[model samples]
Target: MEEQLFEATRAGSKRNDAGPSRGGGEMQSTTGATSLKLLLDTNAFIALEPTSTAVERGLEFGAELARLAAEGGHRLYLHEATRRDFARDHDLARRSAHLALAAKYPALSGIPKSALADLLTRLDLPAPPLSESNDAVDLEMLAAVGAAAVDYLVTDDARLRGRARRTGLAENVLPLAEAVQLLRDLSPRPLKPPPAVEHVLSYQLDPHDPIFDSLRDDYPGFDAWFAGVRRAHRPAWIIRHDDGRYAGVMLVKEETDTPYGLPGRLLKVSTLKVTDEAHGRRYGELLLKTLFNHAEHHSHDAIYVTVFERHATLVDLLTAFGFRDHGRSPVGELVLAKGRRPSVQDAALDPLKFHTTFGPPAIDTRAPFFVVPVEPRWHDVLFPDYPGQLSLLTGEHPYGNALRKAYLCNAPTRRVAPGSTLLFYRSRERSAVTVAGVVEDVHVSHLPEEVARYVGRRTVYTLEDITRLCRSARPVLTLLFRQDRLLEPAWSRGELKTAGVLNGHPQSITEVCNEEGRHWLQERLNEQR
Candidate 1:
């Protein structure tokens, strides 16, 4: 059956030398790095063709993929199943044309029946007799990914992606947009980091930009209100993409006369908008992170934003960070407020709850503390504000920009309770504890997809990195934590060892289980205050 299938699909197909070279299925680039093997599903394969009709419908993701493949020296391939899929097309001429077009790309080696069956079982798919050609092809492509036959299976099928996610292959499956983004991330580029949020005068903004279109539509006086803000020289934070387009903006003001009967000096978020193009990049969280950092740095008592109910995404993000709904504004917009002041009752709240409630720089003393050793490379990315390490350009990453971040490791120590205190001990040259954080959640998984989903945008590691980490045999420990503060006058390795906070240097996530060590660490923290 397999031999017949192969012969039937290859009858009129001819190989092209410029395409993937067929051997043991290993392709090498001129750069000496092993080329990343990408298996394209039927839809992606057709859509990615230079002359495909879909290109006219704004399928530029194909162009980006092609550029990445050319520049990055990656190899793209079509699976035998995809060829079979094309052969099944009812239009005889179209079928021949597609097979001819597909022939230009290298065909991935077919999976053996036993291996394919096992993969299907592992992926929780039913055995054979798939009613549709697309369904059969989807299973085959996913099976190829399951066998690690390809680095990634690129597809636009939402149902296929949903299945991959269910089967723990989410990390290996890429929708066109994410695939393009990932490829861009992997491609060689300049060393300049992504742009950080900039504090600018409100007058510097162009109100006519499409970013304000929604705001203008929602509020009749948005344009005039913005003009007044510009006239008053109100401060705003803006994030611009590398291409010099506005990605997000947040307009802010200081109000002494609290509306809705709120207390203390208030920092009102007048307008917070992230452009449609930057939707899934965590620019919203990035903007909020900047806002919270600004409010806390300037010692604002409370922070609030009045948002309409229509913006569900922003509302969910705000409430997740401990912003409470305090009734509605005079114009019917929902008022969400978060108190910045740490209170005595804060110590009683769980570690995660406490950080979210008070917005970091506050930890529950009642929680147990652990010293997690980190290398300088990761330490710099996770704690970008570390005094001496601030100069290191770790590049612009979502994890680095947000207060809520995840740490992935193969540490054997199980059971890091949520709300536990973590002292990030930066190892190597500057061997000392430099950062503190409170745990929000803890999970252990050997599956890369599960780890990726759990960490979401909170992780600094790429999916490729996560896959490699999972391949180490040991289960990956994901620590979801909120960064609390940079430890001032960082406790040195020598000091920690002397104080019994460490018996030498911590090689893994070590707990300060001893009373002496805990007490000594507490005294040091108290001294810093």
Candidate 2:
């Protein structure tokens, strides 16, 4: 039976947007309960606007958010304050742009006077006096939430979020990313399997490949750049879809001389583009991830990109992955750079401080580590670069060795939690338990979309595989872990048996509760130290 759902709302935010349901719409819960109603804060709507400067470099950030909401059966609402904000803006051009985007969501109007009065009293704020003509809209926005006009408010403003939390509406307030993840969990889509990597061939691009034509707008001198890349023997990895079409492309070049003042081996991303059809599906993210791995393997001291200022979405993405603005390039383009080590202090403290940002997960010395077996097929992503073997792992992640994530649906992993040590065992030909790390966070949700949005930004899984995993009622558990330490002289299955750490072949995530098993694994790991 479906459980009853409830919503309480109250708000006076830095940026405000609210709306009522124009139609009963598709906002119905799969379990036949009331669906979540989301209101966009004014800044969110502003972000959707394409600036006059954003020409060929413009991004459709709004479309992706809308898609998630619609697919997840959530109704988008706009507070009447959004309209007032639009009208109050003195910049005619910017106001028009804001209005254009605002038109997409239905605007909510009319509020009960008693509800507004009650909300003001509860919030302990005075009603805007007649003298304060400019303040009524903001008060109205708060009243809308207080009256439960909408279940949640989405915003990017930090101050607004703080205010919401202070007023005991923390759960009702959400960041844009969190809002999308939540909605997806509430309304996950059906599954569709992705094509295997075996089907997609990888090859180096010749300087004269016609494929460069499509990228001319982004890279004006593509041919010249390609010649240099080819001469350096640095291939621009391209992934072809099953239909033998270009899915995405990425180009990287090692630069010794850069205006960004990146010393040593600095890698510059020259091109990263995905076909139009692959936009929301994460084709671009896949290629960019490959470029990161390539840079890491090549011993690049830093990675940087020269992007047009108009490409806000791309810039935001790079920033999210720890790229900092190194000011502007000689060509007047934005110079974003990311280094192996984040700060001078970190380098001074520990030479290999790549993943030390959060430090290692706290250790629970009293508990035994969980020994989980991973198949060879999934090893490339789950555990990259099996020593003495070629590393098929290609991707740039904010968390290097310090933090890694693994997706699980098994019974044992669901029981895993923060501070739990995990000893990973590689199955098949490798047939050894080699790496160990500590768990930092565990996310278990039945919605694939929720899992994807939360971790998909860094996952190795394709969209199809992620969607498929989320399709079933079985919960998808994503384990975020940190501080990976490789075990020297891997413990082979035979070795494990002789040591009494195993009785037979292990198939799932098994906890090492046996005292002997814990001692044996710890002894081996301690030797490396």
Candidate 3:
């Protein structure tokens, strides 16, 4: 009876009647159905592109996905926005390629223009003068997903990911790496349930604010209680995001606060949030993954929560993801339990790993090609030893000789002059003709995550900005995007470790040209020719 009392009274303290944080523990999903409807972000689409050196991994990724769909019953969601983006970008590429041909005849240039116009209209490009809303682009994506009622928005983009978390846009925004691994957790592999980043917000906030004030009633002394819980469990961790200073955090605990004599293994979750001014991102889900780890580490018998009985939306999630209602408290508050019923308890938990790890993902990001002035910030950092950022350097890569292109795009990350260096990473497929590059460049298409970081946000160029910088910035070494592939087809299984790009044992080499970065980029110029 005493235990039941512990579970009973706190039903009201739950997040929106989230049964007061279940006391005792949280359970691993050793037997849960796939209650999530996953929607891939732009990065995922790029990963699926055919030209990526990581193309071989795509086959395995798909196979893993199919396995998950068969067993867990998860519905993969794709937004019209994503499809539209692809269409528009594809149209741009086709038009640009055709225009290049038209340029040879001069007279046909007008024809390509006409074709381009038709392509643009066919893509239904959202007319510019876009919404002034901070996350207008993100909102477009969200509305696209919302219409389909997806359970999660999986992405790695810092800005867009945050927007989803702030507005409660989707069920969760997960990293591409984790998203693939989740698929691997199904049959054929031991179900190793690792800590998951579902609905994680990678920053923190003051609980005293107005929004929190309204939520304070749930935990009369939430701040105090949280401090104590952290001191008790000590599972605090830091998260990293792109172009941001603050790392996201999570405040979760295995609490003793049970509700209404229910099965008491409830893990209390709090402040699964990102700090204010967080570029709306996927931090919410990033933080939740941390708690998932804590619950598993503590070996809690079950997880329970107190939340509003009417949060139909949240309720749908909780129910789908593996939480069950242990019957509401006598006061009419809802009580939820994990590992209670015979339903979804994460079958993956029974195994040692719940997610699969691949070599760093590859991306063929596209942006309008152009010459841009490399900022002093980039030069000073990358080439302090160089006499002049104007010096030209080049290399021949055998890896780029076969299967794809025949030249090395760029060499090691080094400093270059302001107007001297031109950098850009383009998608090989369609959309995003290319992502303009500046000082530092991230070759996600060929490099791993860690190495990519060393190159992350190093560039501060947009298609328009590139033009301004080109006029005066000194010419630095050119970093182009070329193709590299495996000599043998079998090497293509699973994830290609990110390091392979940095150190691969290939057999040939090619010296490439930087014509694409030449003066005056005609939009839609192709890199191949």
Name the top lDDT candidate: 1
Q: Put down candidate 1 lDDT per residue, 121-145, tens digits, no spaces.
A: 7666677746356777787787777
State the lDDT of candidate 2 residue by residue for 1-529, as single tens digits: 1111110011112111113322233344444434456777775655455555753221244556677666545678888777877877889988887777788788877867776676566567776434224346545655566566766677666556555544555545665654554444344354233322121222355444444566676677766766666666655676566565666667666675855567767788877655544433434444545655566557676778888866554664566355778888776889888776344364343211333221221133344577777765554444444475424334221112113454454343456766677777777787888776766556666543344434543344433455566555655556655545556577889988887788767776677767887787667654443
User: Candidate 2: deviation at residue 49, Å?
Assistant: 15
User: Candidate 2: where is the Cα deviation over 4 Å?
Assistant: 1-28, 31-72, 83-223, 227-233, 241-245, 256-261, 275-277, 325-327, 341-353, 356-422, 425-478, 481-529
Worst 10 residues of 2 by lDDT: 2-11
Top TM-score hit:
1
How well does candidate 2 score on lDDT at residue 360? 27
Report lDDT (CA) for all predictions.
0.70, 0.55, 0.33
Q: How do the candidates rank by lDDT, highest first?
A: 1, 2, 3
- Candidate 3 has its poorest 10 consecutive residues by lDDT at 3-12
If scored against the real structure, what TM-score would every candidate get? 0.66, 0.52, 0.26
Worst 10 residues of 1 by lDDT: 1-10
RMSD in Å for model 1: 11.0
Q: CA shift at 497, candidate 2, in angstroms? A: 6.7
User: Of models 1 and 2, which has the larger lDDT?
Assistant: 1
